[model samples]
Target: MKFTKETRNAGRGRRDLLSVAGAALATGLAGCSGALERDGDGNGNENEDGNDGDSDSGSDGDSTDAAELRETLAAADPYRMHQYGPSHVGNAGGAGPTSDVDAVWTFREGADDSHYEIGTPAVVDGTVYVPENHSVGDDGAETVVYALDGATGEIEWEWTYPRGTAFGSTVVAEGAVVLGLGGSVVALEADAGTERWRLERDFSDAVTVADGTVYAINTTYADPPTLVAIDLETGRERWTEPLADERMFWPTPPAVADGTVYQGGVELTALSTADGERLWSKDFGNAVTGPPTVTDDACYVPLGDGTVAALESDGTLRWRQSVERGGRGSGLHPVSSPAVADGTLYVTSAWRLTALDADDGAQRWTTETAGDRPPVVADGVVYASGLNVMEAYDGAEGDRLWRYETDASSSSGDKVAPVVGETAFFPSAGLHALRGADATSD
Candidate 1:
């Protein structure tokens, strides 16, 4: 079950100078309890990429349509792992919370009278699986994964871990909820929150589960990270492959789509989901900002040096577009992962949001905003979370639809992206579920 390849850096990347320091900054959250280690642009970028989750269970049977979410989420890829599924599309699809949203319920609990941050959630059959790590009594720490009723935002069951660092992502698939906790990959029964399996490692990133398999990226901190595949039914390792020969400081989780698993690091690689077979890898001369957004026809990735690149299935470059404004002293170097829905690509940079045609990478529209996390598209609206602000825009016209200002951490990419279930979930120290005042399930 050891998948290793002697793959070295394809070429010296442009950001190699800061790789060592950046990696520490990227993975720093693993050291703290509930504190997020994020690469911020004040615009939504990765949703932090792999914070997403999945489940085969039915919907909440409310205004949110789980069936519809399953359909559109599966349109390009499975809701395999986090960051809004394997395609990394960030589209909740189906019946999402529209304009004039109201808080239906909020999922929050304090440990020792202090609140912890909530990570991304995966909804299945009406339950929300979310994880959080909190400090206890100034010295102790605890990691808890709660299974909440999507309709009511009430905790139905929770599984607690002795150690923290597992708050990065919570994923539910194949009747199991999986997450990375304190350098280990843990799986629990989705309904009972009972421990199903655990695999200890040194360093673990966000996990992705697809087609009864769990893909995990782990490292020992002394070397580079590795991509590991595990059987969902059993804790047995399927295969593990080294993602980079040289270390990657802040690589996002792997995206599984179209029978291919796309991994980003110093290089962008495509692998076979069946076995750890390398399909193609390209040295982009830059670092990948987030998970690769793989669509039916092409794959898109945000580069570290502030640009977005499109690739064909064969790993060939299609087109490269610069979302970075302020080249000649504009001082704007916006970097975030790309979210694609309805053949449109959305990226948020420093103080601006840009929409582009998914085909050919032509600019569709751009608007000035304060978003920093990767944008989430659901029901044709782009949800951007920035410093003390949340704004929605028309996916096609790029017009500002509505704005909701809040005390929520502007570091939304680290806490929770826009998780649209029966309602659109936002993280503001606690998990908030919102639904449109006049919206109905389709």
Candidate 2:
């Protein structure tokens, strides 16, 4: 469903705005609240440090293995639900809007003379790419994607896509921005903000980018729906393949792994990334809305009716677990995609954050977040967000660690992720950064 300010009960008038802004500002300040107090050993050696090394090194391993794992997890673009990635890292991660104690950065559009509520923002390199729009539709209004310095939130450049809403969250690859809108895919220069190429095809589905390729699903009224791939550097069509069957609306992107792209249309299909050739497809008899998580052995797909299924790379069903019983509990719809870390698969239903055995699909534990954002796991902890709550859980046993409350109904976009850092960076709900408390003993 479309989002409307009028539908929100955040309250109206000046008082509400100030309350929201002040709270947001306070949260942003926490971004740079301070270093995580560490033991004098210099190694993240505190019992609490888990794999302790240094305050930074312990948790922030720049090792080849860790980096490769990070690259693999982010490989399929976990931010397929929101516009931005895990968190603005490097310079952008250190930028002022994010470098304070509890700093909060909100995603807004160009409204009135100064204010606007907008869609997701895409972070590329050291800049944050935001959209300024008048409305959403083919002839609704035009959208301009602006590249802002992550540190100063300064606009470095902007690219406008005529006749498109700039509504979907964007992905980056090979120094180019790939966005889905106006029934098409558009690419822009990372530095100059110039349009490099565009493919017009109405897409309500989100997209993912990897290894210089783009994958997106499109739903139409008359024509059958399709999943298309385009060259990252140029918007030229690499291939356009029909979804498992016609009339299926894929709201999410496809996952890429082991040289094959995994997407759940009417069925989950493993397509050869090199040429968009279908290697195999698996049907679960349930409609899937987002990208499946592909590991070395399995693909995790979340279905719309309230279930998640595991399939092998060859289109064979391994196991299936129901996300919600039959009736609607709290999460009216399970919009967030599944996130895998270590050996568990984290999934969000309308009412809970659940951990499942990656190998067997058995329940491990469940939290009460009914998350709309993908959960992030680090140091044996799992983080998730919902309408008004952000929570951290023990990854091993699913124990509640801590819970923070935001304003009522303040949720980030569907694609947002809990960015791991010395402090967890909550970029959604505008932009709030929560710092980790001093580490005690394990």
Candidate number achieving the greatest TM-score relative to the actual structure: 1
- The CA lDDT of each predicted structure is 0.62, 0.50
Tens-digit per-residue lDDT, 254-295, candidate 2 = 677667877665567777878778888766665565567766
**Cα TM-score per model:** 0.77, 0.68
Candidate 1 to truth, TM: 0.77
Instruction: Please give the lDDT score at residue 388 for candidate 2.
Output: 37
Can you write out model 1's per-residue Cα lDDT over 184-227, one digit (the tens) per residue? 78899987999999998754545677788888777535366778
RMSD of each: 10.2, 11.7
**Candidate 2 overall lDDT versus native:** 0.50
